[model samples]
Target: MIDAQTLEAPTENPTIRTSRRWSPGACVWCGGTESVEEYRNEPRCATCRHHESVIEEARRFMGMYGLRPIGGTLQSDDDEEYEHRLGARDSRRVLNEIRLEHQPDPELVRKALRPRAAAVVAEGKPAAKRPSTASSATGSSRTASASAKTAAPVKTGTVDIDEIQTRALALLDQLTAIDAQLSLVADQSGLAARARRSDLEKQKATVLRTLAALEKARLSAASK
Candidate 1:
């Protein structure tokens, strides 16, 4: 016969467990096993703590804007309601993209917040007074008057047809003389002589075109 103390102590496997034990493993999100005590309850890494907090903040922001998603499929006949639902959907999509793509850094998030904060503050500031229409019109009128004063006055006068005709005839005479000189220099063998002839030919062509234009204008003015 065994004694009671010997019988109780002789069992190799105990039927009842006295303490809790957790298996060590990598975090599901960040694949990290460090800081086991910090993430003992949740299966997330320590670095992801800030990231989770940022997601919560984004949710709160959407809530503040009345843009939080509601349960069930959205069915809206009213345009305003539809717009609100659409805005909420877009905001959620953007937030989800940020949560997935970015690792949360405090400085970067703070910098991002600055512009929106500034915009809100600016909205609260008093608006500057706008100039009245009468004053604006007066300013424009003064500008117009100043411009009129500074501008060169246009000469409004009739063309002297006889003078233009006489000038055209003189140009024709000079052009004929130049053409004759050009023909003489064409046979000469130097580069300078060739260039001089080319210049004279250009002058003759210009004179012919100008004389034609002047004669046309003279006839038109006479008819009028």
Candidate 2:
């Protein structure tokens, strides 16, 4: 008969030990617990993993075409906010394919993709303050001052006319692709196709506006 202690003894199972050792409690990248998966012996949430994969793919695509990945909100789709935006993934994929197919000059690509955050911020209005009867005059003057500040011309020292022209041409190419996608979805009655059409239309409009702005800016820079 086996003793009670022997019967109660815990067996050292290698498989169980290995599983316990590798099990992840939280995501290694974002520290979130939802949908965590083991990746290369490390735990990562699905979102972070997807982001990593997209970034890796972008880098590989850029490298293959001899283009450097410019780091900025305008150039990179890797931002958290962009990742959450509708059709951002599709835009990145489309952009990558276009870049690979065209293989635009590396210098042109770099110059064309410089950060435009200052201009973007300058174009936006500041938040409104609460109304105050006691300081109406003071508030009016302050508002005027703020308006003046925001209305100040965005510096164009970093902007090159050639770069703007190149960027505009690239955007036109992207717009054509987006239009093609929109055309494909135009006849489809499925909900998914409608959704895709909406995204493509929005992207097309955005690109057209951007191209127009780039043209204006290019003309302005050339004049200067």
Candidate 3:
């Protein structure tokens, strides 16, 4: 019964028909709905956001280690994930280096990381002291003399061979891990990637050298 001139096609309500909706407390990174925070305009859970911050900070800190990043945006989720893993790995290495350099007490580091746990551990524990060079040398000589006197010649040789084999196997495993890391970094194009590749190459070379040395020792031991 409507007039043809007055009749118009029904149009969709844009607000009601739109596909995207504002989701509060939803994490884009981990698909979690708890402790969500907005990071770079994207919703992320607290843990995910903390890790993201760590990765970003690590990337910025690489320059201190003489490694520079080639400025580029991540093209895909895979690229972002790769960088995240790399950053975490590098961050662990950096932390280890710092710990080694500073020689901080393990308990202190633990307390610093988890302040709430500090109350549980007992305080005033004496730090262990390292032996002096002279004492260490004397102890080593005494131990070697005792072992030489008490251990059977065949047993000693067998033990030495076993130890050499174990060391060689460990070096091989390390080399394999380094190769895998290198392969991962191969496809990535950036100064940071290049630096990581270089570091891995150096580690591989060192491992190869140690492996060669172990082989030489094994051969010498076999000849004996």
- On lDDT, the leading prediction is 3
lDDT of each: 0.43, 0.44, 0.45
Each candidate's TM vs. the true structure?
0.31, 0.33, 0.31
Off by over 4 Å in 1: 1-157
Best-performing candidate as measured by TM-score = 2
What are the per-residue Cα lDDT tens digits for candidate 3 across 64-171? 121233123332223444474476555433322211111223233233334433332345322221123223223222343332211121221122566677777888
Per-residue lDDT over 2-46 for candidate 1, one digit per residue giving the tens place of the 0 to 100 score: 222222322243331111112334332233344422221233444
Residue 136's lDDT in candidate 2: 31
Question: Candidate 3 — what's its lDDT?
Answer: 0.45
- Determine the C-alpha RMSD for candidate 3 after optimal superposition of all C-alphas: 24.7
User: Could you give candidate 2's per-residue lDDT for residues 29-139 as a string of tens digits?
Assistant: 233445776442234456545654565444433322223332333353334324433233553442222111112232332233234323434667342211221133232
User: Which residue pairs collide, candidate 3?
Assistant: none
Per-residue lDDT, model 1, residue 35, is 47
TM-score of 3: 0.31
For residue 34, model 3's alpha carbon misses the true position, in angstroms, by 56
Superposed model 3: Cα runs more than 4 Å off: 1-159
TM-score of candidate 2 on Cα atoms, chains taken together: 0.33
